[model samples]
Target: MKIAELGADGTEQAYDAMRQLRPHLTSAGFVRLVNEVQRPQGYRLVASWDALSGRVVAAAGFRVQHMLAHGPVLQVDDLSTIPAARGQGHASRLLAWLEREARFLGCAQLHLTAGTHRYDAHRLYLRHGFAIRSFQLSRQL
Candidate 1:
């Protein structure tokens, strides 16, 4: 198993894996959207590849920023592992990597919002030491 920061060269593989988690995005728009988010939001992508097959099985989209609540934080906007690859520790490995990266960048916290219905993911986060500190309320504008 190998974890790597994805660049343009890994975009296609990353998109294919990430699409499983965010099916609303079309292939044509994925790259464009990632680029747009990166420029203004400090967005980044990382992927985990199987050691033998060498296929990207998991992906994460995140950024580092400062906010009043947390001075410098690494906030994960998206994290997904292809269904077939679940339970293989791909996401866990990625999360660990992110934590290390966060510390290296002087981030005080790591944060993410999971949909209420995603019970399994919530379990994973809880096991990783994340507490449910607040509810994230949103409305369509």
Candidate 2:
């Protein structure tokens, strides 16, 4: 397994894995959105690829931000491994890579949000030494 940043040629492969997790994203719209919004804001899409199978099995979308409260931090916006790819340590590997990147960038913290009902994900986070420090609340306008 190899983890690499998604570039132009890897779009479809990256989408295949990510779409399973973010089903709300349509292919065309995802492409357009990534070009129009995500890339400009420094969002990066990275994936764990199985070179032998020529497929992306896991993906993560992340970015670094500087905020007064946290100074510099790395925030993982999305993380998913295809159902078939779960339990294979792909997510764990990608997260470790991200943590190293965060440290390389001098980030003071790493942050991400998991849904309340995702108990398994919560367990994974805890296993990775993450602790709950705050709650995130949002409203639809």
**Maximum-TM-score candidate:** 1
Q: Extract clashing residue pairs from model 1.
A: none
Residues 1-141, candidate 2, lDDT per residue (tens digit)?
899888754566677777876899998777777767887898888899866687899988899999999999999988888888888888998999999999999999999988898888899999999999999999999
lDDT of 2 at 92: 94
Cα-based TM-score, every candidate:
0.94, 0.94
Worst 10 residues of 1 by lDDT: 32-41
Q: Model 2: clashing residue pairs?
A: none
How far off is residue 36 in model 1, in Å? 3.3
Superposed model 1: Cα runs more than 4 Å off: none
Predicted candidate 1 versus true structure: per-residue lDDT over 113-141, tens digit per residue? 89999999999999999999999999999
Candidate 2 worst ten-residue window by lDDT: 7-16
Which stretches of model 2 miss by more than 4 angstroms? none
Error of 1 at 29 (Å): 1.0
Q: What's the distance in Å from true for residue 41, model 1?
A: 2.3
Write down the TM-score for model 2: 0.94
